[model samples]
Target: MPEKVIIRSIISPHQRESFTQFIPLSPDMTREIGRTVKEIFDSLGGAALLKSSRDVYVKPNGIDAKAYCYTRPEVVRAVIEYWQSAGARQVYLMENSTQANYTRVVFEVNGYRDICRDTGAIPLYLDEEKTIGFEFTGRKSIYDGDPRGYDRSHCEMPVTVTEKLIRRRDENLYVNVPKLKTHSMAGVTLGIKNQWGFPVHTSRGHDHNYNLPYKLTDVLSLLRPDVTLIEGIEGTVYGHYPVTALADRCVKPFRVLIGSLNVAAADLAGAKILGLDRADVAHLDQAIKRNLTGGVTGLDDIELEGDFSTLENIDILGDKPSSGKYPADLFDFFPWDVKVLKGKELACREGCVNNPLTLLQVLFHDHNGRGGWTLVMGKGFDPDEIDEIQGRVLVAGHCAIEEVAERLVKRLGKKKVYLSGECNDLAATAEAMFHLMKVNPVSFLPRRRGAAVLAFLMARLHGSKSRVPNPLSHLIKMV
Candidate 1:
């Protein structure tokens, strides 16, 4: 008989009809979360896992500092409190934020510093710590024989993790806390996708293209979480980083928490909660294929603890999961006059295609849509085929730069051509787009003018070298 992975899902008594109703952390909500976590530990032989002498490290999904994008601080605090009550030696909350952003800034902006101070839990910024190299022997490329695929020559991938996590991995507990949300690239961001924070920001772009799923799975194979807890209290729809203005339509109040010992099993349940099947998520499919599901061969192998059927299916990317294509009407609602001309040959949904599109979505929604530019991505665009080109030309990604940047620049003059080179470099993309639209990049920040200026200064003084485009450097040009 195949090993059964036990998944515990708890639905809170707090239910609201409106999706926009913001649920703040209350005493009742805390009690429910605490009970749910205790129940999960009890089911998993609490005596063996929750030891008094063990060190605990909790990894929360701090992808972005924005609300509803990262893991809720309330959830992290509950996990820390539980471990502390069990007499754990130490409980550390750690994360490396997404590219172009600093983890320290995220901690400050997301109220993690207060959580750490109140709970006596230390905040470990992985970006500032030293990284150790681990061997990766898995298949390097998703494509069989493509020269442009992930480099097979380099067998070691350096991840930013402390020596404690590397040396005392078996002596302690590692928990993964990720928010349940749909991704424009990976279909869904859950426990499995949360490990993307392990790699340094500079090296992330190496395998950020079509091979992202395999890369994410490879990272999981190296450092699998001991406990996977997905915070589903409030889930984001359409995509993970929807602006606050769009929260009414984008955020859903699920009031549910899902946990499991196996990351794959936890993600499978989380994906199902988001109305995604195993086939819809490439990483989940790859994890099962590689036997990383902790004997969860498929969705049928899971033994659910709660009434999963009561949870309605929240649409993943407008009810079109696994399509690997952005919604046809993503830009229709906005009155942005920008024209996106993608190449006919190759467009990796995970990288060049979605990166700029997501940024554009943010610009359109929050910044009032900066228009009058022609953005070109991917490859195989013959300059001769295009009869008339709109406004200024912005070439994105290495593929587009290599294919048509020179010709486009020659036709449009040097002043009109803006190049943003790299697969998923949000910093470069933002700079190019801002330049083309003639908008101040600082206007995109959520903080007020004074706070934004102070935050930018603080980020530069004590931020990681791996941070792309440096927040201060980008803001300096605009100011």
Candidate 2:
């Protein structure tokens, strides 16, 4: 007999006049979250699981410090407090934020530090720790073979984690906490996709292109969470990153929490709530086919506790009439003067094509549209088209730079050409585009200027070489 999988979701019974005014850290909200977390924990046998081990490691989606992009600190506090009440000896909150952004800075910006100080949960910044390489075997590439002649069957990647998490895996409990959001690359970012942050920043781009789904699944194979809690109080659309300009249209306040011991089941339920089918999210689909879903073969297999019907479908970019096939379509939401040119041969939707475009959306919205610029990505651009390009050209990704950097420099001159060489390297891309568009990085935080400056300074003092927009880097380059 297969193990039974039950996914329990709790919807806040309280009614509010305006969903837009929902405050995540409000006293009322915190109490509600605490109650919901305890109910879910009791329902999912979390206490029984905790009986075997007193140590707990909680991994939250600290992808970025941006609002609505990461798991709310309030939700994490509730989870930590619940675990403590259930006789947990120690709870360690760990995360290595998105590439280019340091975990220390992210923790400060997102209030994880405050949560740790208050809840007595030790904060673990994975990036600051040493890493060891772990090999994942018997994994098959979900996409075509890499152009660089590398086999995806066996992958050995470095991960920044304590020895307790690896050596004493069975002795401690691992909880996965992720925010509900739509991803331009993986369709939906849930429990399975949340583990993407485990890999070191440098190794992130290795299979980030077409084989991202396979890479994500391979990570799951190694670091499968014992319990998954999907925080859906304020879900985001139009990709995982927060879009302040599109907050009205993009952010969805579902006021619900989805939990399960089986990560895949929880993610499947999350996908449904996001108005996506099983096949829509490639990572979830692949995990199901690989039998990593804890015997959950289909939606029928899950015994759901909450009413999914009452939950409205989130409006993601993919749901648009244009299907969001190209990065250019994202610009339609804003009146930004930007041109995204993809390779005629093939544009990797998972990385090169969408990553830069997503960042551009944030920049355009926050800064009120930079001047007209052309972004060249992927490979195989026509010479005539390259010559006709106007203004500064941002040559993004390794393929684009190798293919058209020389031509762009020759036709448009060296001063007109900017290079952000890496597959979905947001830090380098942001810096390159910031220079090309002449946007000040400090200007991004007009209201929280002091906090932002202090965070950056502290991260620097701590010897963090993170690629997040650095004021000093900008000052030196622009000078």
Candidate 3:
């Protein structure tokens, strides 16, 4: 059994200091916070719970480089600072960003690069590391935690996790610092939601799988976290449905949640603080059904240890679409991309808004727009639509690639029309879009062709996305 969960509420968002400024903590304040953190570990085991001879991993929410959506560097730095002071010998900050080969890009852009430099915590990009695949024969499990409800024990689980991270499971501890964000599918992305990053598979680039609910359970069962910290300094509401780009999605909850020895207790506490019902959070409810969260059916089941008086005052906003499906939130995210995604009739049959809308998010967040973007994508466009496109146009997928290649070259110029081979090749698509975006990585480590070939071949051994060769020759130069 885990110790009682702890909730520390910071009502004043404005009073908080620099998110990146690492300063000397007042001895009094440090001791108070440290005492609270020590109790959190005592619930799991003892003060040495984080002490290890090998590398410890501080897993934070860095799904993308987007602002107010991922975990803040200060939150991660606090964890590193605390664990090191608590007798930890070494620690590594790690996470797998969505769909980008360059996990380093996400970390560097989102402030982890500097966090690692100042705190002496190494940054490990999970996707860049080698992966190992496993399948539970008698147990059926999903990777993305699909809410459709599949029996985990009977499903074939081909989940791939970073071998470097998996092998370290027995040698060290993990502190999962998940951001309090509203997920499009699983409702609230709390402690349990953070584990979804372990699997190397994807329902799609967008982070929603039919089996996400169960997939999350499988990951939790596999790599159990010793401490789960939920940060609500900044969050997203109606996260999937954007009203006005970045403004509508973000929220300032001004709070922090801590839990351990049990993942369910931690995430349950997170949902409660957000004023969310346990019944509504699919993975949390599913975790309860399997008796995974120590039989925590709701927040009332867990005991709180710290300041939690303002549970009701917390404003999480709605998780679902507040105003129904709106693409403007996504399109408006980038200033260069003003034409708005047309060809609604051409949305992929798999899921109408999934590919088109998500592609725009991936492109803008991952790359820098030079001339900005004018995207016209999906299966619907008649070749005639190509003539109407302005600025640099990106025609995604092989479906649209065939029609626009020649026309785009002639009208826009050879540099303008970018074609991706696979229909949903986000990596390839990103490489194309970025050529025009002129994205500047935090630091560039130029790799020779031999190095790229060596990395590519090694990835082949691990069944990685690197198995697919990048057509953009310059991408090899970018790394």
Candidate 4:
């Protein structure tokens, strides 16, 4: 059995009134958050648990360039403050952002840099050194890597990890600060998902078939963090929701911090706060099977504090929308699922006029049932060539919003005009035309690879709408 995990909660709303009277934290939520965090650690037997004489490494989530989409800067500040108070030496804040974005950038821009500077801890990048390969002989699992590339095992593979971070002197402690977010591939992302940083040189752009949750836990088991702090102050139901654009979706005042010795247990407790099933996450499932942190089967192992009823205000994870699909749910047709963009006389005034064409290409590839695809452009072709193909038309892009809606309404019945854009509000506007106000990722890519496929599919499914002048040729360079 793994050690019992201690989980704590402090729920509140992100209101100006609730944030009154606090220290360097500025917001009242900070003081409550600090207290709540300290309470959990105290119940777990205190910071003395990390008095071993070794180098302590801290890893915070840094997958995106967005600030609010990540862990709150105050949470890291509070943790560092508490750790310094506990008499820790040589604190290193580390992360390997898949996007190659800087953790310091996120921290500095989000107010964490000052906290670290004032606290006297240095920041380290995880991708800076050579790594040693480690094998997982435990069990056959999901995300099996092909050993043929490096003469390795199906389940076992070489992993590049920093040597300096491997062994702590004696009093070393590793703290994992992770943000809670919903993943499109994995059901949810949390502390375990943060472990993707461990790989010394792997770029985030590399695609893997299985969910990252399992692999993350496997990596963490090797690192064996002394404790984990999951910051839930603000999280997204939709994965990769940029901090600046969508922090308000966080309906509940999750002014709480959850901590635990058992990473799995802590994750379980955190997932509960979000109303997600532990089993729903493949990483947590794999962790349980491999017996990492004593295999927590449920939330029963956790000791909760504060009024968790505040969580009742949280929306169901499935019911949440990411970017697109307000009146329509994007999740309904996620990843190979059918999506019907039923519209009449659709027209593209801006963005990718060739978007419907590109979507048609995608549909063709889909029909071929082949996985890998590439859309390459060669020498210039005549604009008249645009008449060669067909599909239902729709205006999708940032520019399409200016006046395309009214024009599109004149051609396609008002009900058929759905605005798709990178902006949810714009898509929501289209939904409003249909009499439902909801956010959606409606912006369509014109002639781009993904857009090509979507356009192709629409053509195959709905037949080509009337072919116009194909102004997309002129705009091709803009893409």
> Per-residue lDDT for 310-337 in model 4, tens only?
3333442345334222121012212242
Residues 226-338, candidate 3: write the lDDT tens digits: 67877665555544322223443344434454655566877766665555666767777777777777666765666667665434444433343442221112333545544
Q: Could you tell me the C-alpha RMSD of candidate 1 in Å?
A: 4.1
State every prediction's TM-score relative to the real structure.
0.86, 0.87, 0.64, 0.59
Give the 10-residue window scoring lowest on summed lDDT in candidate 4.
326-335
lDDT of 4 at 272: 62
RMSD of candidate 3 to the true fold?
7.7
| Model 2, residue 253: C-alpha shift (Å) | 1.0
Q: Write the per-residue lDDT of candidate 1 for residues 1-479, one digit (tens) a residue.
A: 33223444444454454533334566777777888777766676554685434888889999776668888877888888888887788888888788767676677667776799898899877776656666454564435675666743132322435355555567778888999888878888999999888877766765567778887887777778888888987777677777666776677666777877878878877777677778888988988888877778666666666544332353423433465332222233443578888889997778888888877777676676568778888988766654378457777788888888788777777777777776777777777766555456556445444554565566566555445553333333320
Best by TM-score: 2
Candidate ranking under lDDT, highest first, comes to: 2, 1, 3, 4
The model with the greater lDDT, 1 or 2, is 2
- What would the per-residue lDDT of candidate 2 be over residues 289-378, giving only the tens digit for each residue? 877777776566666664443223434223433342212123345435778789998687777888888778777776655758898899
Backbone clash pairs for candidate 2 read: none
Which candidate, 2 or 3, would have the higher lDDT against the true structure? 2
